[model samples]
Target: MSKKSKSFFSHFTIAHKITMMYGGIFSLSLLIISFFVLVNVTVIEQNNIKAEMKKTVENIDDYIKNGGELSQETLEALLENKYIEVNVVDVKNHKVYKNSVGKLPSFVRQIQSQPPHGFLDEERNNRSEELEKKGFKVDIAKEFNMDDKAYFISSRDGKEFVLLEKEINFEESCYLVQAFKMLQKNDYYFRSFGLRLFLIDILGIFLSFLIGRYISRKMLKPVEEIQQTAERISIEDLSQRIDTSGPDDEMKELAETFNSMISRLENSFQKQNQFISDASHELRTPISVIQGYANLINRWGKSDPTVLEESIQSILAETEHMSQLIKKLLFLAKSDQNRIPVQKEQFCLNELVKEVVKEMEITTETKRNIIIKEQKTVEIYADSSMIKQLLWIHCENALKYTKQNDSITFHIYEQCEYGCVDVQDNGAGMNEEDVTRIFDRFYRADKSRNKEIPGTGLGLSIAKWIAESNDGKISVESELEKGTIFHNAFPLKKKKNQKYS
Candidate 1:
């Protein structure tokens, strides 16, 4: 087959393919059945013809033995039953009786008049000897043809006419020669039967095709509906959902799965749009502040040292803030895309926590009492730098929220096979709602506090990302005005056994 033909066949609809398959199978099965039936009928008819011919020959033999001549009644009975034509031939190869063509030649009486035991006993012996010498294997009964007429010769009791009786004694031996000719005449029976069977097969094939088409259509109806629903839905219009109402079959499951996928896509698209909008708003503020300060420096701020120094510092601060915000946003984008390269190693959680506390105390101008409590050597498998960053974010948040002289305690220990670090501060804590969304990007607990503190709200979000990338979890516990505690937990690394350290 050519590729074009193959492609054409492949393009056939499911219903067409099913219809063709069903039609082919049904037509083949019907043809096989019809063939067997016709063959069996032919065999049965042939057997019956052979059996009736033998019976008629036997009956004629018995009548002649009782000194009764061949009667018209026997001839009429055989003719009425449509049996084979019969011919009785003597040992001299002379026909004694022929039913269809009337009496035939019989020269036995003239050849030997009262010479031997009966009419043709001597001739019978001579014929048998000749047949055996010629490898004929002469039997008591045999079938032969002469002049297009069939005869059954039977030899019996070594009598004159016993050769005729022996051959025709069994019902299976004798049959009408014209019976084969007559059977040929009824060839129309086969033709008619074949025509009827062909018609039936054609009808059956047509019905099978119809049924297959109907079933395919019914089965694929749900799939077509799903296709239509999907075609109507686009990225801009993801609100369209397939509403399936049926038993929990495969079709119903497919529809439900499709709906679930659409719902996820819609949520992701919404989040992406929101993130872009939030990023624009956050970046716009720093740019506007820098622009305003640049304007101030240009407008007579260059003449005054104080104005020049203040505008320059303010512009630098705002630029730095914008740079930090952009870096955080880029990091989050890489994290979301699963492109963050994490190199994990074994590190002590307690040591990292102590270092972060010391660094915070040195860097900040505030006199807050930072204390390390419950510090222990708890080893964990994670990216050490990312874990340190996570700890610093939490410590910075504590310092930012707390006033000078406020106490912030750091705890590092192992609990339940997990290395845990906790940063607790006596700072302005959050309500239940703020605690819930504390890790959300660009989410500030109090807008007024944000102005006073002058800090980007992306710290906790970045901190959460760092902890999760290191296979750790971050959680917060806080009450309004009672300060807040941020806990980070990681699975403790198992120690490998060694023969020598």
Candidate 2:
């Protein structure tokens, strides 16, 4: 096709394309059927004409055999209004005995001049030849001529006719009888049939095009709605969803999927907003403390030794807190972006847990008793440093909440195909609601006492990420004012002949 044709078609919608496809296919099919019908009808009409011509020839032959005289009046009376013409000839005299017309067409004379192509019954012709050689005579010729057609379409009057010839033997004389019948009625019938079929095809194509357009639009309605709904949605307004009220089909599924996407986006945006608010609040407190310490140091640091020393210590503490907070924030940001790379290796959980317990014990040296309740030889594949950091976080958390004379117990065992670590503290435990959200970043239990807690709330959140990055799980159980138990389980993926005490 040309570029112009392609451009033209590209402008058409899917509905229009469907309509045109249906209309073109149906119209082509109709034309093919009509063509076959025309051929069949023409053949049937030809057969009918042949049968009628046979009967008329037989009638004239019978009349001659019955000794009835032939006349123009008799011929007209017999074949009136039938569009039939007859002619009788005397073969011996070479003269016209009877004719429907006073003068014959020049074409008719040309046809009569040639002998008929009767070649029927070779033995009869042989017999006639034998008699002629024995001084007897016979007039045997073909019943049809060489130039005859099944249908003779005459150009003189643009009419269709069938021509037939027969030889009659009457009282030892031969007579030639010719019959002609025009097919004007059959022609008229075909013309009328073609017109009706064309009209019907036009109506059928129009209806098909209309029906195709309607169905295409109906099917694509949901897609249009999806586009419209999407156009109205933005990061600021992700709550808008496409309505999915229809049959359980692909369109409905698409709409449902679109709505689900929007819902996820909305949830993520909400979390992002909350994170920003909480981060701002947490950073603002340390900033205010540092600013106050700087103002105090600037006013009295050079003049008074005690005031200068106090301000330096206070400033150092605030700076350390802010540094820890910022580090935790950066760690979480990298984890969220999947930029934290973990180096995994086989490590002894029992040995690692014992080391963390000993280190934390030496660092605190508190009145609280940190006890190792149980130990097991369980090997797992994970980043040893990450696991150590995780254990440290949990131990530090346990130390923070537990008071003097309270016991912080540690346990290591294999449970359900996992190497497990459990840290139980007899400290200020939280309620069930706090336990549920304990791992959320920046979430601290007992907001009333949060100011007294001397640590950032990102420890447990970081611990959770470390465990999950190593394909492990963490869970916590706490009861208000009773205690909290933190559990870590890693899949026992490797085993070897190694021991640790």
Candidate 3:
């Protein structure tokens, strides 16, 4: 087939394809049934005709046995009652007796003169040779016989007859031949039945095609709706969703899955737009500050030592802040893209927590008291640097929120086969709503805290990412105006062949 033909077939709608398939199946089924029915009916009628002819032959044989002479009246009465004709032929091929109702055809009369004992075999061989001479092939293995009688079917002037012959012991050597006309009424009935069946088959195929089309349309309605919904959806408006209110079938499941996909795409688009806006806003302020300080130094800072020093320090601080923000953003982007590589090793949770607390105490400017409440040697499998960064972020947040005289405590312990660390602070705590969203990127609970404390809001988000990447969990418990506790938990590593001293 050509490509154009294939393309044309492919372009057919589902309903059209289903209709064609159903029509073909229905038509084939009808054809097989009709063919079998016709063949079976014809076989039954032929058997009935042959059986009746056999009975007539038997009756004639009994008459000759009883020494009753077959007269014209007897033959006429037999014809009226049984629709049979009889003929008697002698060995010399002479007609001894025949019914007055009808005369035997010439072909049947000629066959009747043959002897009865091996008559069937002889006739079959002779017919085969005759057909072969006329350039027609014949299967000599195929022979026709009924009981002990030799029979042949013949058609004369468009009328069909079954001729059967049986030998009887008469005073003279004679054979009884019976002829039964193939019933014209049966032919008429078959023709009428065939016409009706053809009409019914045609009607059935039409109805089945229509029903198939309807079912296909109903099945594909959901797909059509999905296509329309997709056509209306755009990047700017991804809020369009498929309706899934129906029975729990494949179509309903498909619609639900499509709706879920649309929801994910919408969330991704919103986040992308929000990230771009936030990044621009954060960078704009730092760039403006750096430019302002540069202008100040250019104008008068060279001659004035105090102005020069202040401007230089301010520019460096702003530049450093921008650099740190960019680095955090890049780290978050890598983490989001699942590109952050982690190198995990066995580390002591107790010593790591103590080290972080000591370092915070030395570096923090506030006069807050920081201490380790509980410590135990607990080994964990995790990325050590990421764990240290998580602890530092928690301690830094504690210091930023607490007052000068407030106390912050670090606790290290083992719980439920997990190495655990808790950073508790007596600081200005947050409410339930703030605690829920505290780890969202760039979300500050106290907006003024971003200004009062020189820090970025991405610290907690990055801390949460680090903890999760190391197969750890970070949870927070805080009450309004009360202290807050941040818990970091990692699965403990079991040591084999080595015991902790």
TM-score-better candidate, 1 vs 3: 1
Give per-residue CA lDDT, model 1, range 1-501, as digits (tens): 899989988999876887777777877887798888777876566456545655555555555555553434554454424435445533233334445432322311222232343343444446556544534333443343222223222223221111122332233222211221123323677778778877887888788778878887877778888899999998789999887897778989999999999999999889878888999999999999899988988997989889889999999999989998898889888887888887777788778877787788788987998888875678988888888888888877888899989899888888886789889998999999999998998998988877878677888998988887766888999987889999999868633552221
lDDT of 2 by residue, 152-184 (tens): 434345554556656677896666666665555
The C-alpha TM-scores of every prediction are 0.68, 0.68, 0.67
Residues 24-62 of candidate 3 have per-residue lDDT tens digits of: 787788779987887687777767776666666777777
Per-residue error for 321 in candidate 2, Å, reads 1.6
How far out, in Å, is residue 363 in model 1? 2.1
Off by over 4 Å in 2: 1-27, 30-186, 342-345, 365-368, 373-375, 494-501
lDDT of each: 0.70, 0.75, 0.75
Error of 3 at 464 (Å): 2.1
Q: 1 or 3, which is superior by lDDT?
A: 3
Query: What order do you get sorting by lDDT, best first?
Result: 3, 2, 1
Candidate RMSDs in order: 9.5, 9.5, 8.5
